[model samples]
Structure formats: C-alpha cells, structure tokens
Target: MKKHIIPTIAFALFTTSAYGQSMQVGFSNVTTVVPGGDIKICKARYGTGYVTSPHKNGAKIHKSSDKGHFIHITKSNVTLHHDVYVMANEYNMSYPGDKGEITAKAYVYATALDRKSGFSGVFSDGQCKGQLTISAK
Candidate 1:
C-alpha cells in the first residue's frame, strides 16, 4: 500500500506540472490577399490541442468571403508535435459558379507559457491564390 501510494502521488505531480504550463490559445480575424486580385476575409480562426489521448488537435479558418460570396473553411485536422501544430487540407471549392479544389496548409507555434500567438499560411485553387494571417491573445 505504501509503495502504490508513493508512485501515485509522484505520477499525479508529474502530470499536473506538465499540463499546468500549457496555454489555451485562440486566433481570430483571418485575412488574405492574392496578388492581382481582391482581398479575402474569413470570419473566425482558432486552434486547440491536448497531450492526452482520445482528444484531437485541430484548427479552423471559416466563413471566408470574397465579393459577398461566402466560403466556409472547416475544422481540419492538425498535427501537434511539441510546440508546433500543422495542417494541410484539399477540398473541392464550393463557390456558386467556381469549379476547382483548393489546397491549404497552416503552420503555427505557441509557447506553453504565452497566450499571444500568430500564424500565416498560403492556399491556392488553380488561378486563385491567397495568404492567411491571424493573431491571437
């Protein structure tokens, strides 16, 4: 009983200290522009991750708009390794009359100690291209 109690307390302390240092990060107001074209905007951008199993790490850039037409990016899967998280998604473009698939990748990093973070990435669909930028605190 004594041996089990000592190990249990040690394990609890280790896990608590590990998770206590992590920050819940959020980013917002995604904006992008492609050269020779108008600017694009997205409603919200956010990312989250966990060290525990059965919980997934993911990020999203959503409700993008161009000239009053709306495009919703989704909750795409992101890979979290240490301090960085990354994702790449390819899907059919669903604009009213447009026809193509867009490919995008996001790379972001956050310190376990800080709440402020930012990221910039790029995406393209045939002739259409843009960069995504977001900052969170």
Candidate 2:
C-alpha cells in the first residue's frame, strides 16, 4: 500500500509540473494604423503561442474558445507622431537622399491573468523593423 501511494503521489506531481499553467493577456484603448490604413490593437497570450487572423478596424475583441491560441498585432508600420517622425527623419538623413528606413518602438498596456507568477506591464514592439517577439507569459 505504501509503495503504491508513493508512486501515485509522485506521478501526480510529475504530471502537474509537466503541464505548465495556461496564461491569458489582454490590451485595449490603444489603436494603430498599418501602412495600408488598416487599424490594429494588440492582445497577447491566450494559451501558448501566437495566433493571428485578418481583422477589420474597430472590430470587436476576439476570444478563442480553443485552449492553445492567442492573438497579436503584426506588420510593423510607420507612425505619424511628430516627435517620432522628426527623429526617424533625422536618422534617415544620415544616408544619401535621406531614404533610410525608420524604426520605432511602440508600447501597449497589458494585463496578465497569472498572479505573482508572470509579468504585467507595457509590451513593446519595433515598427518598420523585423519580426517582433511576443512571449507567452
């Protein structure tokens, strides 16, 4: 009986550790326009990895019933903010014909469902640059 109980407890602990807890994060209020004029907001981490679908501007927030998908904004775009524009232009001016690409970082307010187990703050992405990292936490 003792041997069987010990094995059962050990199995339970192992299983629990093997499958980490799921996390959900949501963001709102902020909006951004893509290069082609499409608007986007960000939502990160519903389950494990990133998930994306083409959505219209001002569309309702999407929630996945499935357990392993999350949503995030993609396709970095240039911003029209005056300060950012000036800075980017200055950087570009260093190149011939002032034709260098501009890169800017944008931040979004975020909240995570996990308490004391993960992070909750402003998430950032580099616009007009390469791939962005959206972690599941």
RMSD, one per candidate, in order: 12.9, 18.7
The local distance difference test score of each candidate is 0.32, 0.26
lDDT of 2: 0.26
lDDT of 1 by residue, 19-109 (tens): 1222222334333444454333222122121122111222222233222222333323333345443444443333433342343333332
Sum up the clashes in candidate 2: 0
In model 1, the clashing pairs are none
Predict model 1's lDDT versus the native. 0.32
Write candidate 2's Cα lDDT for 23-132 as tens digits.
33333332333454323212222112232322233322212213233222222122223222100111110111223322333344322232233323434333221222
TM-score of each: 0.33, 0.24
Off by over 4 Å in 2: 1-19, 33-37, 41-118, 127-137
At residue 28, what lDDT does model 1 achieve? 40
In candidate 2, which residue pairs clash? Answer: none
